[model samples]
Target: MNNPDSLTNHFLIAMPNLADENFARSVTLICEHSEEGCMGIVINRLTDLHLCDIFDQLGITPDKASHANDVVYLGGPVQSNRGFVLHEPLGKWESTLSVTDRFGVSTSRDILEAIAENRGPEKFIVALGYAGWGVGQLEREITENSWLSGPANQDIIFNLPLEQRWKAAAQLVGVDLTTLSSEAGHA
Candidate 1:
């Protein structure tokens, strides 16, 4: 059985051998983990799209101060067209999943509207889609050495430059991924 409490509010750093193109070199923020399943957003994969593109498509006039030019992220492979906003200073939003005292994920238009008007959370990252795992799936992956997870650090998620988040998240567990060998070792 998977330990439901073990993964919530953690960062899942993809192992070097995890060759899936979608997740390679990815750093995922595990927002929820339960017997039911797991869900997360890839914190480091910037897509070609920008926040302004999303706002324009949705007919929301983004505030100039809202960092509308920031690159949008490819959160994960699931529900690629949906938007998930990870933000700090968690507050009430139309549809939000409070991940921790300092972070939350919002999936509602109202929050987007608030952001467009510069009334949303102090810091936010807009992403499309999310990574999901069925019951026991993530635990199995961990046991297989497919990922290295540790407590999520807001600095990596909210402050680090996009190109550095993957390495920084791995370093949270004292790992320097560059030094890791792709093949599993036999003791």
Candidate 2:
């Protein structure tokens, strides 16, 4: 969207009061946003599954080296069975939604294959499913103080430890989430 405030390439830091299990204490990377909806991945939520599990399930080989890469994140609740690969320095892929010139979310096997062999982008995060919001839903949630959003930070997504992302993302915009009430106010 041409709208300057479109949250594409931003982070949605869940507010303290939002108790939805899927979103509570989550830091979601908004990769694509439009009049239709918004699609993002929960960058900080870890699942029992790992990249090796994905490689095995897909019959990909040379996965032994991936032992150091237990980096599969629980992206969100929708399409839980599918995989989305978020990476930087957007490269060509079979099915990638280019988030920014510097970022992309790919759902193609080729990207995975390249990654398996160390021929992929410098950094990547394999996520299961994704967080989605229909038109106006996310905006309304923000209006209700369910989330605090700001421009996406690469370090927070790819470099920082998962446990720190929620607060770190919020800090990008100068909000100290620890000081916020877990209760919403009503006039």
Candidate 3:
């Protein structure tokens, strides 16, 4: 059995051969991983929606016009209407999963309200939905070479542009995915 703790707070960069339409070339941040399963958010898939659109839908008036155009990501394939706020300088919220000392994922409307009111964390990426794996499912996929994981970095999550994040995350483990063969090699 794989150590569940090792998967938490890491980035799961999909292998080039990952044929799943939902996860091709995706970068996912594993927020929690345990015997029960694993949960993560795809950080680089931007949707057509904006922060302002979400705020309007939630009936919260956005306080920062500068942030109105911020992209809202399609976190994963589950709960597409649900919001997940991945942020830093972790703070107490109505419902939050503390991913690390410096990072967290909040699934509460309160956090959304705080962001709209300009009282949220210093750095954050708002996503809708999240990726999930059933018990042993992720481990099996990893063994099949479906992913490459490395310690998650805040800079890549919040600073890098969406298009660069996939490659950047892969590079964390010294992998230039472009140079990798999609076919698995046999010795």
Top-lDDT structure, candidate number: 3
TM-score of each: 0.94, 0.94, 0.95
Q: Show model 2 residue runs off by greater than 4 Å.
A: 67-69, 183-187
| Cα lDDT listed for each candidate | 0.91, 0.89, 0.92
lDDT of 2 by residue, 8-109 (tens): 989999998899999999999998888899999999988898777888899988445643366688999999988998998799999989888888999999
Q: Give lDDT tens digits, candidate 1, residues 44-94.
A: 998899988999999999877886888899999999999999999888888
Q: Can you rank all candidates by TM-score, best first? A: 3, 1, 2
Candidate 3 least-lDDT 10 residues: 60-69
Pairs of residues clashing in candidate 1: none
Pitting candidate 2 against candidate 3, the one with the higher lDDT is 3
